[model samples]
Target: MADIVDTAVSAGSFTSLVAAVQAAGLVDTLKGPGPFTVFAPTDDAFAKLPAGTVEALFNDIPQLTKILTYHVVSGKVMAADVVKLTSAKTVEGSEVKIDASNGVKINDATVTAADVVADNGVIHVIDSVLLPA
Candidate 1:
């Protein structure tokens, strides 16, 4: 199996996500031997941002990197493990709230697809982009 980056590439729904990761210079980290849990936001999710937010972020590498890194958490936490927690800290140093009362929610986003295995991590496709508090 390929890494998280490769998996997202294959799904073809995370175009903006891939670009953001590239912009953040996190491709190598996601490609490394890790067991990460990625709260992957689809391109559509990014569209939910305020108008021109994506463009502004793309223009600002540091801010974009921070937002992108907020989606990743160390360790490959699968769906089951997720339900046992109230929150999980991200690589970006922010904690994302988890709600399992109805399906699974990560902050304001819902996990549309979960437990997608990759060589380096697990990808949980979410419908909303997570922002740092």
Candidate 2:
């Protein structure tokens, strides 16, 4: 099985997300031996941001890294486990609210798909980009 980065690349819907991860210099980390749970945003989700938001993030590595890491949790928390929780602390050091009462929401983004298993972790597809306050 492929790692998170490879899995995301093969999925083909995470182009913007993959690029942002690379730009943030987090490719190795995501590819590492961690059992991460990533709330992945699709290209369409990234497009929902204001004009130039992505471009500006590319230039701001620190901010980009924060936002990217905010999508991840430390362990391989699958859909079943995620639904049982009210919140989860992200890799970015902030807690994201999980509202499974209504179709599973990670912060303001809805989980469109769940439990995409990768070698190193799991990916839950979300409809919007999650930002840390």
Best by TM-score: 2
lDDT of 1 by residue, 7-60 (tens): 999999999999999987889989999989999999999999999999999899
Measured against the true structure, the TM-scores of the candidates, in listed sequence, are 0.98, 0.99
- Candidate 1, TM-score vs. the true structure? 0.98
How many residue pairs clash per model? 2, 0
Cα distance off (Å), candidate 1, residue 3? 0.6
Model 2 deviation from native, Cα RMSD in Å: 0.4
Q: How high is the CA lDDT of each candidate model?
A: 0.94, 0.97
Q: Residue 89 lDDT in model 2?
A: 98
Query: Lowest-scoring 10 consecutive residues by lDDT in candidate 1?
Result: 20-29
Task: Tell me, by lDDT, which candidate is best.
Answer: 2
lDDT of 2 by residue, 43-87 (tens): 999999999999999999999999999999999999999999999
